[model samples]
Target: MWKLSVACAVLCSVSSVAHSQSNVLLYGIIDEGVQFNSNAGGNRQYYLASGELNGSRWGVRGSEDLGSGLKALFVLENGFDVNTGKLGQGGLEFGRRAYVGLSSGLGTVTLGRQYDSVVDFVGLLEAGDQWAGYLGAHPADNDNFNNTNRVNNAVKYTSRSLGGFTFGGMYSLGGIAGDTTRNQIWSFGAGYANGPLVLGAAYLNVRNPNVSFYGSGGTVAPTTGGVPGSNFGSSPVISGYASARTLQVIGAGAAYTFGASTFGALYSNTRFKGLGDASSGPVSARGISGSATLNNVEVNFKYQFTPALLVGAEYVYTKGSGPDGVGDVSYHQGALGIDYFLSKRTDIYAVAAFQKASGTDSSGKPAVASLSQITPSSTDRQTALRLAIRHKF
Candidate 1:
C-alpha cells in the first residue's frame, strides 16, 4: 500500500508540473456595423453593408514555457462575413492566420501559413487598414503588404528589437510537386518605432507571378482576356507563361503628440517590373515599366475630445501611371471618424469616407465611364458612412 501511494503521488506531481508549464487561451473579436455607399452602381446597388469597420473573426492562441527564456506559440485565426456567414480567404476554415513556431531571446521563427514581413510591418501605416481590401488594395494586394491577406505554405522569421528597430523575412512555397520554380515568393522588411516616430520599409519579389496569379487563385481573373492594359493580347497560358514580377515598396510615417491631439503623415511608393511578353511582341510592349509606379500620401489629425471620446480625420491621395504610351490616373480620399469608449476593451465608432478618381482610360479619352469598372476607380467618387460597435477580449 505504501509503494502504491508513493507512485500515485509522483504521477500527480508530474502532471501538475506539466500543466503549469503550458497554457492555451481562446480569444477573438466580432465587429459588425451598418454601412451605406452612395455609388454602388447597376444591379449591385449599394445597401446595408457588413464588416465595414472591422472584420468579424475568432481565434485560438496558446503558448508553452520551454525552460530558460524559450517558448512555443501558435495562432489560428479565421475571418468571416457576418451578413452571409461565409468564410473569407477562399473558403479555408482558418484563413486569416494559422501558424506555429518558437521564440527565444534572439528572435522568433514560425512555420505554416503566415503573413509576410512587409504586410506585418508596413500595413499598420495605412489609413483605416486600407479600407479597400480586395476592391481597393494597391496593386490589389498582389504584393502581400496590405494586410493578413496572403498565406500558403509559408515560413517567417522576426528578430528581437534592438534600439527600437526590428527586422523580419518570410518565404512561401509554391507547393508544386516536383517543380521548385513554379510560384515562389520571398520578402524582407525592417521597422523602427520610438517615442512619437515610426518608420518602415520592405521589398518583395514574386518569381513567375503570372503562374501564381492565375493558378494560385489571386484576385485577377484569368479569363479577362489578356492583361488589363495590353492591346488585344491573347490570354497567356497558365503554365506556358513566364513573367518574373518584382515589387519594391518603401513607406514612412510619423506622428507627433501635443497635449490631447496628435498629427501624422505617411508616404509610400511601389514599383513593378517584368510584366510584358517580349517573345511575341515588340520590345516596347516588353520589359519593366515606368508607368506601373504608384505613389500615396496621407495626412491625419486625431483629437481626444474627452477621456472616452476621440475624433479623427484623414485625407489621402494616390497616383498610378501606366507605361509610356498608357495613361495616368489619380485618386483622392477623405475620411472622418469618431470613437466612444464604453470600456477599456469595448467601443463604438462612426466613420464617413469619400473617394474620387481622375484619369484617362485605354482609349486615350477621359476614363470617367470606366471608373466603376476599375478596382480603385480614379473617377467613380463614392461616399461611405458606417456606424459600428466592437468588443475585444
Candidate 2:
C-alpha cells in the first residue's frame, strides 16, 4: 500500500508539470460603427457598418514548450461582419491569419497564410494602424498600409530584437504547377527604436499583382480586356489597372515621442507596370504596355489627453500618374479622430475625414475624389464621418 501511494503521487506531479508547459487561449474583438457618407453610389447615404476602426475577429492561439529555449506556436484567426454575422475574406474560415511556427532566442520562422514584412513593420507607424484606421489610409491604400490583403502559402522569418533593432522577411510561393514565378511575392523590412524615436522601412514586389496578390481573376487571357472579380472592388482609383503584370512598393516612416504626445510621418511609392499588351486591341480603350505610379506623403500626431481619452489628426498628400499620355492626378486628405476608453478592453471612437482630387484620372477624365471605398464623388471632393465602438477580449 505504501509503495502504490508513492507511485500515484509521483505520476500526478508529472502530469501537472506537463500541463503547465502548454497553454491555449481564445480571444476576440468586435467593432461596429455608423457611417455618414457625403455620397454613395451617386447618392447621400447613411449606413451601419462593421470594422470601421478595426475588423471584428476571433482567434485561437496556442504554444507548447519544447525545452531548451525553444517553443512551438500557432494562431488561427477569422474575420467576420458583425452586422450580418457573415465571414470575411471571401468566406475564408481563417482568413485573417493561419500559421504555425517555431520561436527561440535566435528568432522565429513561420509558415502558412500571413502578412508580409511591409505590413508588419512600417504599417505600425502609420496613422492607419496607430490611430485613424481605414479612413486615414492613403488613397486606395495603394501602398498596402491598410493590410488590404494577406499572402497565401507564405514563409516568413523575424529576427529577435537586438539593441532596439529588428528585421523580417517574407516570401509567398505562386504554387503553379508549371510556373514557379506566376504569382510569387517577396518583401523585407527593418525597424529601429531608440528612446522616443522610431523608424522603419520596407520593400515589396509582386509578380502579376492582379493575379498573384489580388486574386486569381486576372488569369484569363489578356484578350479579356481586364481581370474579373479582382479584389479592387468598387474603388475607381486603381481598379482599372488591376491587370498589371507587376506591382512594387517602397515605404518608410518615422515617429517621435514627447511626453504624452507622438508625431509621425510616412512616405510610400507604389508602381504598377505592364498594364496591357500593345497588340491586345486597346485593352479596354487605354494604351497598352502603359504603367502607373503613385507617391504619398503623410504626417500625423496623437495625444493622450488623459488615461482614458485620446486625440489624433493627420494630413496626406498624394500624387498619381496614369499611363503615358493618360494624365496625372493628385489628392489632399485631412482627418481627425478621438477615442474614449470605457475600460481596458473597450472603447468608443469617432473619425472625420475630407478629401479633394485634382488633375486627370486613369480614364483620361478629371479625377473624382473618394475616400478608400466610401464612394466616388460626382465632383472633386468628398467627406465622411464615422462613430464606432470596439471591445476586445
Candidate 3:
C-alpha cells in the first residue's frame, strides 16, 4: 500500500509539471474600412474594403517545455475577409501560417508553410509596414514588403539575438520527383536593433516564381493551365512578366527614433530573368527571352501627437529598365495616414495615397499607375483615400 501510494504521488507530480509547461493561446485581429479610388477601371469608385490597413487574421500559438532549455512550439494562423466572411490566401484554411518547430537557447528551426526571411526581417522596417501599410508598399509590393505570398513546404531557421542582432534563413522544397531545383525558393535575412535605431537586410531567390508563387499553390502546379492566385487581383504592376525563369531580390532598410517621432528609409533591387509571354500563363516567353531590373527607394516619418494619436507620411520612387528595346518605367508615389487609438484593443484610422507612372510594362504596353491590390487607372496617375477601424483580441 505504501509503494502504491508513492507511485501515485510520483505520477501526479509529473502530470502537474507537464501541465505547467504546456500553454496555448488564441489571438486575432479584424480590420474593415471604406475606400474611394479616384480612378478604378477609368471611373471613380467607392466601396467597403476589408484589411485596408492590415489583413484580418486569427491564430493559435502554443509551446511545450521539453527540458534543458528546449521547447516544442507550433503556430496556426488564418487570414480572412470579414466583409465577405471568406478565407484569404486563396481559400486555404491556414493560409496565413502553419508551422511547428523546436526552440532552444541557441535558436529555432521550424517546418511547414511559412514566410521567407525577407518578410520576417527587413519588411518590418519598411514604411509600408510602419506607416502607410499596403497603400505605401512599393508598386505591386514588388519587393514583398507587404508579404503577398507564403512559401509552402518550407523549412526555416533563426538564430538568437547577439548584441541586439538576429539572423535567419528559409528554403522551400520544390517537391518535384526528379528535379530538386524546380520551383524551389530560398532566402536569408538579418536585423539589428539598438537604442532607437533599427536596421535590416535580406535576399531572396526563386525558381519559376509564377508557377511556384503566383499559380494555384506553393505546391508545384502544371506550368501550363494553372490559374494565378488573387494576389494578382487587378494590379498590373508586375503581372506583365508573371512568367519568369527566375526572380531575385535584395533589400535593406533602417529606422531611427527621436523622442516621439521615427524616421525610416528603404531600398531594394528586384530582377527578373528569361521572361515569358505576358498574355499566356506563367510560361516561357514566345520569342527572345529578356530580363528586367527594378530599383526602389523610399523614405518616411511618423510622429506621436499624443499617447493615443499618431500621424505619418511617406514617399517612394521606383525605376525599371529592361534589356535593349524593352522600354523603361518610373513611378512616384506618396502617402499620408493618421491613427487614433480608441482603446488598447481598438483603433480608427485614415489614409490617403497617390501615384504617377511613366514607362512601359514588360508586355511592351504603356505602364499605368496602380496601387497594390487595387485597380489600375486608365491614365498614368491614381489617387486613393481610406477610413478604417481595427480591433484586436
Candidate 4:
C-alpha cells in the first residue's frame, strides 16, 4: 500500500497549502455491505456489495471570502467502490461532483457538471436519498427521484432562502456545433421548509435525453441493437422508452415531521415523446413507434425509537403505458429498514425489500420484477436483504 500512502501524503500537502489561503475541508464516507437476492435470473444469489445504502465517496470543498456578502467556492467529490477500490461513476476523477461557483446574498450560481433543478427540489424528499439508499430506489429510478441523472455543461442558479422558501433553475447547453437545439436540458424548481413541514416541486425537459443525460453519465454500451444514444438497458423501464426525441418529468413531494416521527408522500410523471428511431436508433421489443409515459407514487413513514436508532417503511406503485396499443405494465414495491448510529460519524443499517410486476413490459413480454440498482429478476417477483456499515469523516 505504498502507493496509497504516497497519494495520501500528496493530498495532505496540497490540502495544507490550500487551507492556509482559504477555508477548506476534506470529508468522506466508507460504506460497504453484503446482500442476498431471492431471485436474480431466477436463481438465488448473494454477494458483497458497495454503496448499498450510500455511495462511498471523498470530497474537498473550499471557499474564499471575496467581499461583503460574497464568496468564491468550489467542490470536488469522487465516488468509488468500497469492495473493489475501483472508481465509481464510470472512473472519472471527481465523477460524483465538480463545480465552482460564487455565492451572494441574492443566491448562488455555478457552472460545470451539476445536479438539475428537479433533484435539488424534489429528490431529497425520497427515503432512498435518506435511510433507504440505492436499494430503495424506485423502479429503474424511472423518475430519477434517486438521482440517476446529472446535467453536464450546465449553468445553475439557486435563490437565497426567503422566509424558508427557495427557488432555482438550471440549463445544460448541448455544445453541439451546427445543432443549437440538440442535447439541451432545462428545469425549474421551488421548495419550502418551515418548522415541521417541507415541500418541493419541479419540472424538467430534455431533448435527446439519451445522449444529453444518459450517455454523459459514463454508462457505456458501444452498441445496443444499433441504438446510437441510449445507454440504459438493464431493464424495460427505460429501454422500452429510449429513442424518444424528448423526455419530460414533473414531480412534487412533501414531508411532515412531528417529534421523532416523519411521514412523506411523493408523485412523479415521466413522458417520452416521439419514440422509435430510424433503424439507426433504439429498437423496441415490440417495435413501438409512438410515445410512452410512467407514473409513480410513494408513501413512507419513519420513527426514531431513540436518538441512535430509527426505523422506516415505504411503499411505491408504478404504472407504465406505451403507445401503438402496447400493453401496459405495473410494479408494486415495499421496503423496511433500520439504522442505528454508534456515533454521529458511524452507523450500521439493514434493509429488506420486495417487488412484484405484472402486465406486458416494453420487451413485449410478460413483465418481470426489476428493482433499481439490481438486475431484472427472471420471475415476476423478487426480494432482497442487505446489511451495511458506514463511516463518515
Clashing residue pairs in all predictions, respectively, total 5, 0, 2, 0
lDDT by residue (263-287, candidate 1, tens digit) is 7776777554553543211223234
Among all candidates shown, the one with the greatest lDDT: 4
Q: What TM-score quantifies how close candidate 2 is to the native fold?
A: 0.92
Task: Compose the digit string of candidate 2's lDDT tens values, residues 118-158.
Answer: 89889888887876888899988889888877888899999
The worst-scoring run of ten residues by lDDT in candidate 2 lies at 216-225
> Please, what is the TM-score per model?
0.80, 0.92, 0.93, 0.92
- Tens-digit lDDT string for candidate 3 (163-257): 99999999999998998988899999999999999999999998877766665343333433454322233566676666567889899999999
Q: Once model 4 is optimally superposed onto the true structure by TM-score, how far is the C-alpha of residue 333 displaced, in angstroms?
A: 0.4
User: Which scores higher on lDDT, 1 or 3?
Assistant: 3
**Per-model C-alpha lDDT, please?**
0.60, 0.84, 0.84, 0.86
Judged by whole-model lDDT over C-alpha atoms, candidate 2 comes out at 0.84
Residue 242, model 4, lDDT: 65
